[model samples]
Target: MRALTYHGAKDLRIDTVPDPVIEQPDDIVLRVTATAICGSDLHIYRGKIPMVDDGDVLGHEFMGVVEEVGAGVRDIRKGDRVVVPFTISCGECFFCRLQQYACCETTNDGRGAILNRKAITPPAALFGYSGLYGGVPGGQAELVRVPKANVGPLVVPGSLGDEQVLFLSDILPTGYQAALNAEVGEGSTVAIFGAGPVGMMAAACCRMLGAERILMVDQYRYRLDFAVQAYGVEEINFEECDDPAELIIERTGYRGVDASIEAVGFEAKGSVTETVLTAAKLEGSSGKALRQCIAATRRGGMVSVAGVYAGFIHAFMFGDAFDKGLTFRMGQTHVQRYMVELLQFIEDGRLVPDAIISHRMKLADAPRGYEIFEEKQEDCRKVVLTP
Candidate 1:
């Protein structure tokens, strides 16, 4: 089998690798049908997350047909079409009981390993991610071995194309969870940082949740313009505005946004200092978007973060959050909690997940797809690949 492998910073390749087989009784081998490259994957691609092994598979968002199932997997049978969540979880755990699948105690192997090596506690194992997770082979290949198969993979019964359900594995659920964390409701005004795929998806979700006005913030004209055109969202190009936070405040008559969301993870742009800090290994990420998110939220408002942070930030607005009584919610999305509802949304014609795709290619062209997405080339918003 040919799988996309991460060689090092800014280097990815298609390499021949052994096919996967069911290892655990609850595991299953999936013949991958479609996969999408996520923005989080860029963090590893640029070596921002350095714990990745050289031969690790390079994807997390995918859907496939079940080729084989372990003895314990009874609900899912061979030839079933399914979309697996990125987080591996045992549905019977305490966290799973609370619907917090991302924090399942039984799947913290990656967190324990990372704590042992770097003294940094990570979340549960993420597919195709670094050793910070379990180093589970990702879905960006011909076939993949899925753990916790009974609870992780959602069986898709519709005749819908893979693109419609592929995002259910990651970004769709991630964006929906991010919006849920913001607590947006009727007449609420929300400001979300980043016009990337996740940010826009959050906007769509907020709209569904009855937000009156949604502000889309980013420096990229292409992305913001797409968000505006696609989601009927208001645009806030940070480059055009002197101060995004202040502008948002002024537009809202000084009360500020009712909810603020940060969708830009680690590699936030717009600051030379943060860039230097990142390159020098002096800071975790730019954190500029988060700073703006804090500044844009009204007092007593909620600030939700869906963007991933691989390390600690040197500076955070703890004082501002404290003074404003802001409620902060962040974590890896408990994808299993929302996959079914999102699929229903798609089936009902209320959401069109595939509208965000800007590029499509074969699995072998994954390197080029990664380059195009990382560089924002050709107005790329998202890329979907097939084997």
Candidate 2:
């Protein structure tokens, strides 16, 4: 099978690898029909994510037809088309019982113990993320072994194409969860940083949930313009301003937005000090986006983060967040908890996840796809690959 593998920083390749088989009682072998290169994959591509070795299969947003099912798999069967959630969880765990699938305790293989030292339990294992998350072979290949099949793979109707349903595996649910955490609702005001795919999805969701004013911030003119055209959001080009938060606050009548979301994660553009600190290994992530979120949010409002951050930030503005009584909510998306409802949204035409796709290529062309996406070539927004 040919799949995309991580070689090193800015290196990805299509390699012929051994096919996967059923490895557990609840596992199913899927023949991947469609897969996508997520923005988070860039972390691994840039060698920022630790523990990813050479030839590690790399992708999380994928959907396919079940080619074979283990004896214990009940709800899903052979030939069923399904979208697999990135988070692999055992449905019987305490967190799973509470619908917090991302916190499932039984799936991490003790690799998460390192984070336990910091009083933060590592999240559930994710497909193709890294050894930190179980290092499961991802679905970027022609075939993939999907564990916890009964729990994580949501069956999709034949009426919807793979493009329409693939994002259920990750970003669509992630963006939806971000909006929910920020309490977006009728007449709400929101400021979202990052106009990438996830940011665009969040804007669409905020509008669907009845947000009257949505402010989108990013350095890319094309992305910001797309957000305005697609979701009717107000655009803020951070590159054009001295401080984007100050601009957001001033534009919002000095009250700031009701909710501020940071969709750009650890790799967000930062100041010289933050870059130096990160390069020196003193900071785990850039606090630039979070700082903007805090400074642009109204007092007692919510600051929701859907972005991925694996470590500590230097000079975090926790004091200001405390002083403002701002509520903070962030985490890996519990994709299983929201997949079914969001699928309904897609089926009803309330959410058009595929509308953001700007490029489509064969699985063999994934290296080029990654290059264009990372370099923002051809005004790329999202890239989908067919195996």
State which candidate has the highest TM-score. Answer: 2
Q: How far is candidate 1 from the true structure (C-alpha RMSD, Å)?
A: 1.9
The regions of model 1 sitting more than 4 angstroms off are 112-122
lDDT (Cα atoms) of all candidates against the true structure: 0.88, 0.92
Candidate 2, residues 262-321, lDDT tens digits: the string is: 999999999899999999988889999999999999999999999988567877799999
Model 2 TM-score is 0.98
lDDT of 2: 0.92
In model 2, which runs have C-alpha deviations exceeding 4 angstroms? 113-121
In the range 18-88, model 1's lDDT, one tens digit per residue, is: 99987889999999999999999988888878678888898999989999999999799999999999998
Model 1 clash count equals 0
lDDT of 1 at 169: 92
**Model 2: residue 382 alpha-carbon error in angstroms:** 0.2
